[model samples]
Target: MDNPQRNDNPWFMALYIGGAGGILATYILIGFFAARWLVGMVEGPRYWIAIGTISGLVLGSFHIVMLIKKMMGEQDG
Candidate 1:
């Protein structure tokens, strides 16, 4: 018997992957700009770079965690 819950369409898989990639990229870009602006007000170039990098890392991590949970069909908090 065919499993109704199983998704075998390649187009759907591609779309899902592409959407996730777009979301993560957008999130990182936003984080980078926000960090840069905030750090620019109180620090030098080095500080701005550092803060942007750190913020991007943290936000990227959180995004990955959410993506994993979502892919696993788990409920997000």
Candidate 2:
């Protein structure tokens, strides 16, 4: 019996990189816009900074979790 070949395409790696970049960019944009809006309502730069930092951290954590789940699923398959 022969073992099946694993997918080792460079394009897949490129796609993963591109997808991660896109997600990062999206989070950054979201953080920027959210901070800007918060700044309008709040009176200080500190609040906006805190809002942006918290939002970025939350989004980053979520992205990491999803990425881990995807990698684990691929390994199982």
Best TM-score among the predictions, by candidate number: 2
All candidates' lDDT scores?
Answer: 0.71, 0.71
Clashing pairs in 1: none
- Per-candidate TM equals 0.61, 0.62
Residue 39 lDDT, candidate 2, scale 0-100: 78
Per-residue lDDT tens digits of candidate 1, residues 1-77?
A: 54455476889778877877777777778767877777777775656666676777678768877876666565323
lDDT (Cα) of model 1:
0.71
Off by over 4 Å in 1: 1-6, 74-77
Model 2 scores worst on lDDT over the 10 consecutive residues at: 1-10
**Which candidate ranks first by lDDT, i.e. highest?**
2
Error of 1 at 77 (Å): 22
